[model samples]
Target: MAAEAARQAFRGRFLHCLPEGGGGYRVEYLEDGVLVVEGARIAALAAAGAAELQGLDLASCIDLGGDLVVPGFVDTHVHAPQLDVMGSHGEQLLEWLERYTFPAEARFADEAFARVAMADFLDALLCQGTTSAMVYATSHHHATDALFAAAEARRLCLIAGKVLMDRNAPEALRDSAVGGIAESRELIERWHGRGRLAYAVTPRFSITSSPAQLAGAGQLLRDHPGVYLQTHLAENPQEVAAVRELFPEAAHYLDTYDAHGLCTERSVFAHCLHLEAAEIRRLAETGAAVAFCPSSNLFLGSGLFNWQAFAAAEVPVTIASDVGAGTDLSMLGTLVDAYKVCQLGGHALPPLEAFYAITLGNARALGLEARIGTLAPGSDADFLRLNPRDVPLLAGRVAACRDIAEEWFAYQILGDDRLVRETWVAGECRKRDGRLAVGN
Candidate 1:
């Protein structure tokens, strides 16, 4: 039976950064929350001017008391099983993936371990106001299944897949190309687009995956054009060297994936920090996106990514925490670190640009612009209510702000999980400090 629809609204002074204003917005005293059903995919958005909301009796209402209701964040790249491995230092890409990542991911063979870690990871994202993400699962198929089940129950938009690695990884964590492809196909049919769930065609990286595995991943991409492709790319010098060694016939680091059919509009390569000009052009040509993991880059001491180059080439870029290497789950902290990265590289990213990168911009890159990432009607009603005065430093900063843009900059510089007071997914108030803020 179809779910019964319900009307709901949140009345308060709300603020969300407009893409046109470049990370600023005009505050409005109004009501705008999600109109949903027990299982409706966001019936509509209710605000003063909408015709559909006219004279309709709301089922339940939440008074936000003038908190921000911007679109929820979209984290383009993260690892579900890497929750416990965050904050480890030194070792660059390949070595680190082997020394820390692979062994740790190997543990996900235990379904219980993956479940506990996934629960913590999802809760952290909710608390930090990230409603959607492209997450990575380890080689174990059950690990990916567990993540999908968790996201489905929570009604969060989560895309993930089992890592495709047939070589250069621990024996237990590796899978033959044939087995990997079969497992991925089965999972995609079962979970893709089930509620807010989607599947990604995840190859760990060119270094860890053999030619057969890369070929298999490419075939998967060709077979399922709607699913996303995610993997590491040009993240570190050593990893680049390894790619060259593995694919000596290929032109460059990006060429390995391109040689296979994996270079397409749905592909998202994390950390293109070290790339030649030609590679950027190829990325633009393929219409692929890059996930700029600033905190991870800094933490791993990977070289800085050239945003100017990305901009000049008109290549799409998304922001991600790249957790385990990235220090915090807060996109605000990642944005601040991104700003520092820009300053260090002799360029400055306007606070608005950084904000867009994590929100709407990221949505565009991930092919989710139509349904999420903005305040427009008909989009999924996922958002966060932020208290600019959530901290003493932020309180002072908010007091001095001349405009909303400056206030956003202040949050980018100082905001953390504490700044988020409420989180909503599809109009359901899923979390609030210690209580279930909204109920069905």
Candidate 2:
């Protein structure tokens, strides 16, 4: 038997979500308990039955008393330095970036600022039950290091990198093609696959990166085959027009990245609100996943994302809290906005579908399905124990619900950080009794 199992404990009441198509998920009940320790992966449900706790001095048992236990949320896109600038009023994407995002990012040159902002970002994620994130750091390389360092100490699965841009922004945030490529390659070699960490080759967007810079970023992607590639595509009308002027040779917005080899199976493109049919087909063909930032889209008055387009193209979509422009760090808020976006587009993002998108759907998009995103045996036991009674609205909604599915809907639509009773990352609880406490 594994050493962690030697001193196993009760897992508490967990409602594990199993994916079912058409906005539906099946909840698995683990009333018996679950166990973990010694840096081991999550165990099988039946493993709880094999070990007896009476004979061994073991790790402390945490009884959740039938709280919901689902996989920790995986956010595909967020700008770490812009955490404080989230609610800045902006009319559109391009103006928002110029007026707010650029100035905010330039501050990351201060390591102290980066450290404090990163601390808040990570703690905010933990409070909301988000243990993994594919984040964007500023043009400052040290900022990226600060983010990875914080995540490493917490044992969280985090993917992040320095933002590469040569044009269309502040001089302080710009990097030449050669310089950016060198820095990105070095970062990938140093951090990729180190612990639960992955490195992302991030270009702000086609509008911000020159051809030379995009080419270098594409080359970096080739060199670091397993590292993720993240960028923006078709977010706002003016942004799309800017891409047209910048890359006149490319057929469309997605083609710019496709030509540079940045569009690939593991690449994640955010805010595909304006993708045309051909662009959608190419995205599907390239096996790229869309990081739908609904709140940001709405906040900036960018076009609404058509989930039906992704569905028709048969491309998987993941939800993200694209913070800074996105008002909240809560995945639940993102889902609620997703529901609104879908409804405005004459469709529905049901509760099960929203839960799955935040969990399994997101993990699969990041190619991290095997490591997390489910309660199956051998996956990491990173998840949250949520008290539906924690929030007054949630309590009222749950009181009216008839089953776990309806109760989950209440949490998804009405819940926020307050609903998160405790968060467990790699089987170590990080938050308990409404206080921040690291697990041993």
Q: Which candidate should be chosen as best, given lDDT against the real structure?
A: 2
| Model 2: residue 233 alpha-carbon error in angstroms | 0.3
TM-score of each: 0.90, 0.92
What is the C-alpha lDDT profile of model 2 across 1-440, one tens digit per residue?
Answer: 23433334555655566656664446565655554443446655432344444332224555556676778888999888887787876457777888888888888889898887777778878888889899998888778888888888788999999899888788999988888878888888888899999999999998878888998888888877898999899998888988999889889999999999998888999999888899999888989999999988889998799998898897879899999899889999888898998999999777777877888889888878778778777788787778877798778888898876677788888998888887878767788767777622
Candidate 2 local distance difference test against the native: 0.82
Q: What is the lDDT of residue 239 in candidate 1?
A: 85
- Give the clashing pairs for model 1: none
Candidate 1 residue-wise lDDT at 327: 84
Ten contiguous residues minimizing lDDT sum, candidate 1:
22-31
lDDT of 1: 0.80
